[model samples]
Target: MFGKRNGLFFDGKITLEQGDPEFIELFSRFAYDEVVNEPGAQHPDLDDATRSMAILATLIGCQGVDAYEMMLPVALETGVTPVQVKEVVYQA
Candidate 1:
């Protein structure tokens, strides 16, 4: 389920509002409802920390450095350690 501020369970630093605000909703639906919420996408074995690390790796692989920077705080808050981040980045 999406949060109240945006249609996302997690905070995404991507600034889509500068161009088309509606895309935010569209993207949220696509990412959350269509992707993240997909039955096969569900991984009960993946804990929050593991998930966060994977996301960080994926961001780095995708060249989303800005988003990666912004997401660092949230990642730590969610119990992802600095060392884990570094290792994930290195792997990416």
Candidate 2:
């Protein structure tokens, strides 16, 4: 499911070679299935857009600039407005 959910943010298909299938399998399960798909009631039924915003805020707070950049498009695709993204960045 790497390419499946990754396509939500990225443009083209994601291709992983045959090295370290374990890493691939675990990352696919967590990033795609768990975080994107099956987010439980951890935040009082937060919607995808809200979750994406929160993720952006957390990334900023953690100084995860690279990860934040990677996730910015995904957050925008989830309907997080540019103003909201800016607010999160400022608040961080």
Candidate 3:
């Protein structure tokens, strides 16, 4: 799902790395809980594609590559298109 880290500072995974330190810190605090405990914390009304699009939109906005990778299978399962997902993150 991700590539190798090129340098010692990073893991070279599919990641998002453009945000304030505070946001990054807070996101780190609960990101695990959200991924582990509340995988469906986002919109539950929409189908997978829409839901995945929402996730993609958010992760890209927050620069959260790990979460994005973790959700990839779900996105695909929910029928999200590569085009749609790419569109969501293209301008990020």
* TM-scores for every candidate against the unseen true structure: 0.68, 0.62, 0.49
Q: In candidate 1, which residue pairs clash?
A: none
Q: Using alpha carbons, what is the TM-score of model 1?
A: 0.68
Angstrom error at residue 53, model 2: 0.7
Candidate 2: residue pairs that collide: none
Worst 10 residues of 3 by lDDT: 6-15
lDDT of each structure?
A: 0.79, 0.80, 0.71
Q: How far off is residue 23 in model 2, in Å?
A: 1.3
Tens-place lDDT per residue, model 2, 11-74, is: 4544453445788899989987886556464567788799899899999888899999999999
TM-score of 2: 0.62
Clash tally, candidates in order: 0, 0, 1
Candidate 3 displacement at residue 34 in angstroms: 9.7
